[model samples]
Target chain A: MSQRHAVITGAASGIGAATAKALRRKGYWITALDLNDPGPLADLWHPIDLDARPYRLPEFDLPVDVLVNAAGLPPRPTTEAKVLRVNFLALRRVTEHLLPHMKKGGAIVNVASKAGAKWRENIAQVKRLIGQANDACLDDFVSAEKIDTVRSYDLSKEAVVVWTKKMTAGLVERGLRMNSVSPAAVETPILGDFTRALGERSTRGIELTKRSGTPDEIAGVIAFLASPSSEWVRGCNIEADGGLTAILDTENTIRPD
Target chain B: MSQRHAVITGAASGIGAATAKALRRKGYWITALDLNDPGPLADLWHPIDLDARPYRLPEFDLPVDVLVNAAGLPPRPTTEAKVLRVNFLALRRVTEHLLPHMKKGGAIVNVASKAGAKWRENIAQVKRLIGQANDACLDDFVSAEKIDTVRSYDLSKEAVVVWTKKMTAGLVERGLRMNSVSPAAVETPILGDFTRALGERSTRGIELTKRSGTPDEIAGVIAFLASPSSEWVRGCNIEADGGLTAILDTENTIRPD
Candidate 1:
C-alpha cells in the first residue's frame, strides 16, 4: 500500500517532533511546518513563522490523512499578543487552510493544554475570541480584555478546546474528525517558562503527577487521536496529563446534598 | 516475551467481547468473566453473573497486565436495582478484588457511557452512590434517590467516571493507571434497549454522528487505554462517541458576556 501523508506544525521540536516520529513508524509521510527546519525527520519541510501575517499554507499533492497543530508558546517572557497569535490564531489558520486537502477520513489533533481545562469557567471570553474574524488584530483584543501574558496563554488554549468542540459537527458531516489533546507540565524546553510564569501552580501539578510527562508520552496520545483506531473519537480534548487534571477535578467536585 | 494477561468482565457479548478480541490481537492472554461462556474468545472463562450477591471474582494465578470492566446493562427491561448492581457496584467490586493481582504497571479501563456526561451536574448524587459501602444495598439507595431505570443506568455510569477520577492519585502512587471510555449509541446487542429507553435522545445522538458506532470502535479505545502507549494518561474518561458529547456541550455553552 502507498504511504499515508500527515501534516504537522511545530515539527521542529518537542511534542511535534515526537509525533512526526510516531507517525513515521506507522508508515506515514511527514509534511512538517515550523520556524526551524525539521531536518530529515520530515519527508517534506515548510519553514514559516506562525506569527507572520497573511497566514499562507503550502498546497499538498497528496491527500492529507492527518493534521496535527502542535506549535505553541508559553506565557513567561512572551508578549500576550504573541502567545494568543501563535497558539490560537495560527493554529486555527493552519487547520482551516489545510482542511480542503485532507482525505475524507482524515483526522486533526490540536495540542491544547491542561491550563485550558477551566474553559467552561471562562466561556464568555473564550467564545469572544473564537468569534473574532481571522484577520482581526489580537493585540487590540488582548488590550481591551486586559489579558496578561499568563491569561493570554490560558485563554488561547481555552479557545482551542472550545473551538474544537464547535467545529465537530460540521467536520464530522464532511467525513472528517477533529480533536485536541491537553498535556500538563510536560518536560519540554518551554517547561522552564511555564514554571517561571505560574510558579507554585505548575510545580504543584507536577508534584501531584509525581513527575512531568515526556514529549513521547504526549505524542502517543496525539498519534492515537490521529489514527483510524480512534475513528469514533471526535472533538474531545483528551487530558494526557498523568492524572493531574483528575486530581484537581476530584478535589473541586461538589459535595453531596 | 511472554503474552501479557488481561481480565475482562461482560466478555460474552458486545463491547466486552470485542475488547477481548482487540486485546487478544495485541498478544494479551484473555481471562473473561460473564454470565455466558466466551468459548474460544477467552483463554480462561469464568461463568458468573454480575447481579449475583457476594460479588465473587476468580483468583488469577498470573499477574494481570490489564483489567477492562466492560460489564453493563441497559435501562429497558431491566430493574433499576439490577442496572446499578451490574454497571457500577459489581464493576467496582471486581476492580478492588483484582487490583492486588495486577502487575506494577497494570492498567484498568472501564466502559462508561455518554449518558453519564452530565456527571458534573449530578455530582452530589453520583458521589453519594460512590461513597456507599461495598456491601451496601443498591436497591435501598435507588429507592431513596427515586432513581428510575434510565436514571439508574446514567447514575451508575456517572459513578464509574467519577470514581475513575477519584482513584487516580492512589493508583498512580502504586504504579498503576485507571481510565474510562464513554461511547454514545454503540451498535451493541443492548442498543435496542437503549433506543427504547432513551427514545429520541439515543436516536438523536446517532443522527448527529451520522451513524451508530460499532462495538469494535469502542473496543479500540478501551484497548488503547489498556496499552503502554498511554502510560501518562491516567483517570481520563475518553469520549469515544463520535462527537455526541461535543455537540451537546457546545449547544449548552454559555453566551459571550
Candidate 2:
C-alpha cells in the first residue's frame, strides 16, 4: 500500500522544505512542489511556476492526504506584482484545485503572519466589497492608485486568513481540517528580503524578541496542525511568534529621553 | 471655520446609525454614505450604492477629519459576496479615496469584528492571497466552495486587522491615525443573522459570555479611535468584544470526558 501522501508548495527550500522533511520522517510519502527541481528529493519534488501556471492536479498527482501551502513571496517592493500573483492568487488556486482531492480526515495547513492580526478592525468593509471588481477594475484601481511594495504582501495574507476562516465548515463536514500558522522573524533566507522591504527599525523590533525561529520550529507547528492531534482545532490561527503580540504595559514605564 | 467632517458608511441602521448619532452629538459634521438613506442626521447623508456605482465627493466638500467605515453586510452565507465587497473592498476605497481630503492629523476608524483573531495560526498563507483575484475568479471560487459562516465572518474581520497593520506606518508618518473596533455579540438586528448563521451551539456560547454589546458601546470605542487621546494607538484592533476572545483559551484545553 502507498504511504500516506503529502503535498507541499514552495518545497524547494525554507519552511516548505523543512515541512516536507518533517512529514517524511513522520512516514508520509511526499510530493514536494516548487518552481525549482528540488534535486535529491526528485521523486517527491514537482517543479511549478505559480504565476504562469494553473495548478493542474496531473502536474503533481498523488492521493494527497495532507497539504501545506508554504509557497509564497517574501516582502519586496520591486516584486509587488509577483508577490500578489504568487503569494495570494496562486495560493488560492492551489488550495481550490487540491481541496477536491483531500481525503477524509485530511488536513490543510496555511501559513499567514502576525502582520495580519489587525484585520479584525477593518474586516467589516472587506466583507462589503467582496466580489464586485473585475480584473480590469482591479488593474485600473492598482494603476490609478500606484500601490507598490510589501503592503500587497500584507493584504494578500489578510485574505488568506479570511479564506481559511471561510472554508472551515465545509472541511469539517468532509472530515478535513483547515488551520493557519503565523510566525514572526524566522531565521530564513527570506530575512534579507523582509528587512529590505520593511526598514531596519521594524526588523530589529521583531528580532529583539530574542527569538528568531528556526525552520523546524515553524515546521513543528505546521506539523501539529497537519496531524490528527489537532483535529478539533479548526479555523484557528496559531501565533508561533514567542509572545511578540502581547501588548506592553506603558504604565510601568522607563523613558529613554 | 468648517465643523469637523465625518463620513459614516452602513448608516442605514444598527451600529452605523448609532455611530452617526454619537459623532453628531460630539459637534462633528456628519456625511452618511450608504445604499439606503438613513434620513435626518445633523449635517448631511450621502446615499450611494458602493457596489453598483462609483463614489463621488459632495458639492459641499469639507475636509474629512474623521472617516468611519461601518457599512457592512450581515453574517449570512448567500451574503458572503456582498459582505466581502462592502466590508473589505469598499472600506479600502473610502480610506484610499479620502486620504487626499483628510487633514494632517485626521483619524480613520474601521469597524471590524472580534472573529478576526485567528490569523496567528495561518499567517503565512493568508499574507499570500489577498487582492489578487478578479470578480470572475472570486465568484467561481466562492460558489464552488462551501464556506463556514462563522469562519467566513471571522476571516473577513481578520483581513481588516491585516489592513490596519499595513496602514499603520503610513498613518504615523503622515500624522494621521487608523484603528479598528471589534465588538462581541452586539444587540443589533445583525445579531439574529449572526446567530442563525453560526447555528444554535455557537450562539449559546456567545450568550454565555454575559454581555451582548450595544451599538453605542462599540461607537464609544470608535469615537476613542477618532479622538486625539488615541494618538499613540495606530493599527490596533481594540476589542470591545467583552472578553469573548478570552474564551478561545478555555475551549482549547483538552479535557478527559
Instruction: Estimate the TM-score of every prediction.
Output: 0.97, 0.49
Worst-scoring 10-residue span by lDDT in model 1 chain B: B248-257
Per-residue C-alpha lDDT of model 1 across residues B181-212, encoded as one tens digit per residue? 99989888889999999999998898888899
Tell me the spans in candidate 1 whose CA falls farther than 4 Å from its real position: A134-136, A254-257, B134-136, B254-257
The clash count for each model shown is 0, 52
Candidate 2 structure quality by residue, lDDT tens digits, A1-257: 46788888888888888888788788888887798876654256666788664345445456678989988888776665566567666777788788878888788898887666655553543232233132224444345446467666676676566657666545655677677777666778887777777676356546534446677767877886686544444666666553344322111111111
Candidate 1 accuracy as TM-score: 0.97
Taken over the whole model, the C-alpha lDDT of each candidate is 0.90, 0.66
- TM-score of chain B, per candidate? 0.96, 0.88
lDDT, candidate 1, residue A194?
A: 95
